[model samples]
Target: MLEKPVNEAPLADVTPPRLEIRNLHRSFEGRAVVDDVSLRVMPGQVTCLLGPSGCGKSTTLRMIAGVEMQDSGQIFVDGKLICDTVFRVPPERREIGLMFQDFALFPHLSVADNVAYGLKGSKADKRARVEELLVRVDLLRFIDGYPHQLSGGEQQRVALARALAPKPRIMLMDEPFSGLDNRLRDGIRDETLAILKEEDTAVLLVTHEPDEAMRMADEIALMRDGKIVQQGAPYNVYTRPIDRASVAFFSDANMLTATVEGALAMTPFGRFLAPGVPDGTAVDIVFRPQHLRIDFDRAGQGPVPTPVDGTPARAVVERARFMGNESLVEFRLDHDGSIMKATVPAVFLPAKGKAMWLTIRRDRCFVFPSEGGA
Candidate 1:
């Protein structure tokens, strides 16, 4: 027989998904709270469920953590089933760690004891683990201190160390940094992210703040009315929103309404391509406040059109206010008297009632079919 070529060994698969949820549903008084929610979190990745209040994000987290039973759903970890309508797994056995708004550290327990509470090993082994986590969190000096002796941010760090003591496969954090001051929150969040990435633990964070989601999440699931309306990377979710509400969720948005004809919607800004929208259908043009270009009015006439910024429109400054890094200028259009907002970087304060020229960036704007036909 001829010599056979040697076959290469197959590569071993790394850790399967750290967490997965399928068709999770929960209701309160016959009203669906978390309706058909599904998501996946891989090892070393952070998935943020972001939305406004009463959007069922917290409930979804609770179900995944096994704190609440889902009316119908399946929960899995590393390709192994953990929970479903028939089967059940207790919260402690699921290997899912939780960090909530309240630090919830035992007032009586020392910092070292708190971090070692969930660990199971000999005295030497548990002590080693506690010391390791305390050093990582930069709280080794407070190892013997009680929870009441630490600041809010320090308490939170201790809580985080305790949660990770057992090396949970999945971590669920519900507004964990909300208690910290604004300046401290930023630093704590970044430090926490680094530690979680080092541990390679999958994280599901719930927050109503858009900035928080954009800053921390690898993937954002935007929820509304107990349903996930959009899910994607932060840049994609902000740049290519599915609807008007989605755009407004991230930042302040301006709108222009026009009727579609020949697959084009004509507005005060310029003509916008309305492809796939039927002729005579109404369309709403949306853009962020930062997309508007401001120009000084000359002799009561606006600046000429350019390729980047389309036809200029005249408006009277209704109000202007300094907003730290930018100045917010509200205007009333000369044509329809409708209000619109624009943001100028640095210091560019215009007197109220001053005439100004505004041009919209056609490339940055989105035209969507209008439901109200306004």
Candidate 2:
């Protein structure tokens, strides 16, 4: 069981965001796709909207880019109201650059011409700007290459360069790396982030991968069926999820239900003292895999205690899996069929089906009321 922190910072800030959505709503076929959603994207920061498929993340992004009309609410970019009930701005006039999942490049146009297509300047000036953007995106050598001649990663870079041609104030990316393989995706994402940071462009990215969001975002907004359930800094959301779904999606956690007894919790595994929990209250504890350390004794040791004071519940190892440099062990409790996952160093990994002792760090756990389903 983790002890709750005594003090935490407030989530909302007083300063205005560079991009703001107020009471945003959208619907299709009488079904609400984006229902009463609101968010803020700070200048020069990457904010990721994450959720499962059909969760309205894409709808929200399209609405912000002016590609889709909102049924209600207002959208402001840099304090300029671009969307309202009666007033609607076309996508071209929104000062927002968009990069789609598919690299939508003109097949007949050269890479350089594609990048220069949207610039409002003389021919020579436009060509010069295109060359600069191509170099910034690390695709200067492929300026003359056609879309078919370039690799997937190369094509993605060209598309990004084209989006940056107008030097828009904000960029909207819809799963820009989802089409590429894992290795290429990593490299391209890094390059893209570097270029965006250098340009200081405010970006709102939509993706379903939690790891991607954790790795690339300054802030994350977790959405459900058309509604944002939680939004905060990456670390804040990971360490302190507001609900069970957020907790499971953000990390690998062993969730167990128990009832609080004084400061202690009584579960089938054993009794544990959980700080900040009221007595007689039913609660669920989220234990991260990294927080638990397991040690297996080759020479059989005596049975491990249920609760090791100052820590959380204890269990014996039921199985262990060797994963490269580390080992993942699953433990079964003495009192219940509940299982917990723990990651330990390869050197200290227990033998498969062997008995091992487990200890959970109290400071690293998160507790919530037992409300069932993840």
Candidate 3:
């Protein structure tokens, strides 16, 4: 007799979300600080909240950690509701951990004691957990060292170890690397991420640095005025930004106003067909410096005056700056006084005021609705 085969669940169906925040709202002095924010963090993945100051990223993080009360919203961890209108769990009752930007290590406590402080288990179990976490953060050798005795990176690691001591379901970090020196910050970032990944801990990290967020986050949420403007993988957001502010924040791009005429965008740099653009609409065009090509000719032939095949503007080279690995050339367009920057390899450096043709890679250009503000 043949036995009936058992049905199997898909991986996604079997895996539960580690944390969820729904319609989170908070206010201060009648102004919404965290405005209807919602996000989900899967187990072991790092989600970064990235934005400039006063954008409400930190306030949202604090609400998730239960450090601040939300006027309205729901926060769940491991499929259990922790915050809602009728029920609210205090910070100590919620199984959440936080690492502040200041490191916040106890000045009088030894590293081992600081790490073991959060564990509720017996003395021996707490000591063992602390040692294990210290080893994971590569601070085992400094177990007995006080906060004052350890270097900035070491102290940061100790703080991280302490946060992990209780093995909370989720970890929230508020600009954890912002206060450290540049060199130490990079090292500690790598070390901290590795430890978190190894333990399969879900993390919600907040930062203002675009590069840092891109490098460390599995997914990124860009916030603006207490709202999430864009959220996606780093490459998607950087390469195809949905808004001008996002494009400007992600990379060095020269933004210029352009008039859409027929199927082309008219700029100082000859006319080119605006790929995927609607005709006869005013729009903002973003040209990344890296996409602008510059070539210098020393034969005194004067650089070619090639107008973009589809557009009516012409480009004139204004200045060139050699920045070690690459040369940035500034160009003036005939239609406006606005200057455009193009980044070329150092080997292609052009003389100042040299006549050079400019061409933008239409495929890489980003066009967004003119939002007036940067």
Candidate 4:
């Protein structure tokens, strides 16, 4: 079990990263599964690899754990080489811990025995370690119980205890909270994060859920097509995405097409700056659903232009659904009959076929040159 330091020394700002990988690549069946992946995790920091399933996140984690070898690249810990093309280190000797969705506790072993499986020491030391980890995970009462005797949440805690018993320098977790019920997952994730921080272990977490990444990560590496498309803090990555796909990944996006003229793109929402783009270039004005504001129609007249919300565009309500704290309303654009969505806080249900004016917050919108355009 990992113990809190009695006299903890402050980490120097100049300390090197705990885990680093450079230009990692892996392939199977003639297709590249993990392509030129590279990332770093600082001591006590959690970096989440977030992307769609089959995007090679798990494969990348496996490569780091040395369960699978990379075709190329180098793995290092605190400036010391662990693996490269010519040199290699075994996974068991690397001092890294792993936790996965399936807790995979031994059904036959007692909770204390399972946690002590990877520990090496005298019997008393092992027992002490097991007891300490079980206590940290709030499962000390289950120490003598078999895996089958505990609930799913309790079993997961046992698995966590087992992983931390060895006091590894780095921890790799692949959707560790996925198996828990939704109501239970958040609390467990918080507890696990707290434990990892207390142990001062570097963490590389893999998850396809953006919310999970946002909540748990110190930094997020947004992966797609076997490559990291963007890496930054959650707020920066969400608000300053590099492309249309990156923006759409985190929320429902609404887009309007426009042609550039005089260094600006004219849309029903009004003109948006298209800086450095040549005239006649096609651009896509993208904004999130929550940024769209709904106003009642004054006969056929839409709302007046404002500095913040450029211009109100007319639309007919197609459908509306209550979503807890907000209502999602879909509208059919009057100008081109395109479907767009808007979110309104609280209960504001407008009838179907009712005309409403929708204005987008200019600061919340992004203008990107259309794909396949010059």
Scanning candidate 4 in windows of ten residues, the lowest lDDT window is 365-374
Each candidate's clash count: 0, 0, 4, 0
- Please give, for residues 1-374, the per-residue lDDT of candidate 3 as tens digits: 97556786545755657989999999999999889999999989999999999999999988888778899989998788989877988889787889988988888888999998888978888888988988788889988989999888888889999999888878999998988999788888998999898879999999999999998999999998999889999888888787788988877888877777777776655565666666667778786899876544445332455433222234567887788998777887645656888887765556656665556656777777567623
Per-candidate TM vs. native?
0.95, 0.88, 0.89, 0.95
Residue 262 deviation, candidate 4, in Å?
Answer: 1.6
Each model's lDDT comes to 0.92, 0.84, 0.82, 0.92
Q: What stretches of model 2 exceed 4 Å from their correct place?
A: 1-16, 268-280, 297-316, 347-349
lDDT of 4: 0.92
Q: Mind sharing the TM-score for model 4?
A: 0.95
Candidate 3 TM-score versus the reference: 0.89
Q: Order the candidates by TM-score, highest first — what do you get?
A: 1, 4, 3, 2
**Candidate 2 local lDDT, residue 111:** 93
Residues 201-252 of candidate 4: C-alpha lDDT, one tens digit per residue = 9999999999999999999999998998899999999999999889899989
- RMSD, every candidate, angstroms: 2.1, 8.0, 3.4, 6.1
Query: In candidate 1, where is summed lDDT lowest over 10 consecutive residues?
Result: 2-11
Q: Give one digit per residue, the lDDT tens place, for model 1 in 247-348.
A: 999999999989989988887776788888888899889999999889989998888888789889999999999999999999999979989999988787
lDDT per residue, candidate 2, 101-153, as tens digits?
89999999999889988889799899999989987887888889899999999
Cα deviation of 353 in candidate 1 (Å)?
Answer: 0.9
Q: Of 2 and 4, which scores higher on TM-score? A: 4
